[model samples]
Target: MLRRTGIPLLALAVFAGPALAGCGGGEPEESAADLLSRAKTTLDDASSAHFVLDSEGAPNSGTLLVGGEGDIARPASFEGTLNVRALGSTLDLEVVSVDGTVYAQLPFASGFSVVDPAQFGFGDPGALLDPDTGISQLLAEAENAELGEERRVDGDVVREVTAELPGDLVEQILASQDPSQAVQARFSIATETGELRRAELTGPFFTAEDDATYTVELSDFGADVEITAPPTG
Candidate 1:
């Protein structure tokens, strides 16, 4: 999944850093469940917001712009536009899907493609930005969440947290991380605002078919944004 759609899925694993960072840690803080509750409360108060995601790889980096509306899980929808420059080439993936059909647009492409709604699952940029799905849920569930330790991502500081993501939630988190049974990923929430700051899943690097690490950081909120999907695809 990660290899086939490297540009799109990259956001799933590495985009939560800013939100989690907003949930800075200091000392003993709230419980995991408490943190999730508080984070949801804060999210409920937001009608709309912006997010910026950066993914780091050897010798290069990628950026994504995500805009979300409505509440996590029940969000009317979301839009994500990703710009990536790596290996001496630039690629852009623009996705917006609300209702049923999904729209996908790419750089150097004449136009967008209308495809089956299923194609846009977590693998697509639309679901990647939706609160009910992908990293959005992880961030919204971050209230009262605990912390583990601090780590470095793209030269930035990040903290760890642990919690259970049941049912569909489990699928979303796992899809983003691309974890195997050998790898154990611990999900965590922020202590200050109960936001999901960091989730660490450790195993072997470059061993999975995905050819990427199973870790991710999500962050950067309230940025300039615009997202629109074709009515039908």
Candidate 2:
């Protein structure tokens, strides 16, 4: 009788183990809004970061930004190269911004020259990390945000959040041809660190007739970076 009772108890324990594991014994999953809030805070607290911006389907004839990669420091400072489509060709311009003034080494130019950022169809890349006017604003203003799949990015687990953004707000961060049209955005935030890993935007950014997609990747948060104005001749 003792042996028979022990067998039954062992069977019960084996069955219960799988049930407990299936019930998700870990912490509860975070809501989409809560995750975005945490990501915003993470970026807001970061002093500097590295970024890569790439766009697709942009018109070839206009003075529009095609791609860029560089480092940005807090309180408005940036150093990087920008790919701009102008005069029917793409020009890679070396740019540096400090305190609202933009300096660029124009193609075939001898030295850096002060120029208007708007001429290239985008504003100060340095402002991309601003807590109030930059990426944080998009997180706070996202409408109907919904959590999507989780995936590994650069060896880190990230969660995707899908949402719609106001076109005017997007226009402020990047350039847009139609500020009245809404833009779709997908944000990938690191699950462990709550840091924004990537942002994908799709909308009529270059022209009202065609839609363009821009992918921005952020990393190296809180990096010790210092940017200064280039010597202009």
Look at candidate 2 and give me any clashing residue pairs: none
lDDT for model 2, please: 0.92
| lDDT measured at residue 38 in model 2 versus the true structure, 0 to 100 | 96
TM-score of each prediction:
0.48, 0.91
What does candidate 1's lDDT look like per residue over 1-233, in tens digits? 65889976768657777777768865665554555566555554444444444332312332211122221122444565544443444455565655444566754666777755333223443454455655557555433345566555445543455543332353444333233323334554444444444455443232234323344444443333444556532
Mark the 10 consecutive residues where model 1 has the least summed lDDT.
64-73
What are the lDDT scores of the predictions, listed in order?
A: 0.45, 0.92
Candidate 2, residue 39: the lDDT equals 95
Q: Where does candidate 1 stray beyond 4 Å?
A: 1-28, 52-74, 83-91, 116-124, 127-146, 150-159, 164-170, 173-192, 197-211, 214-226, 230-233
| Candidate number with greatest lDDT | 2
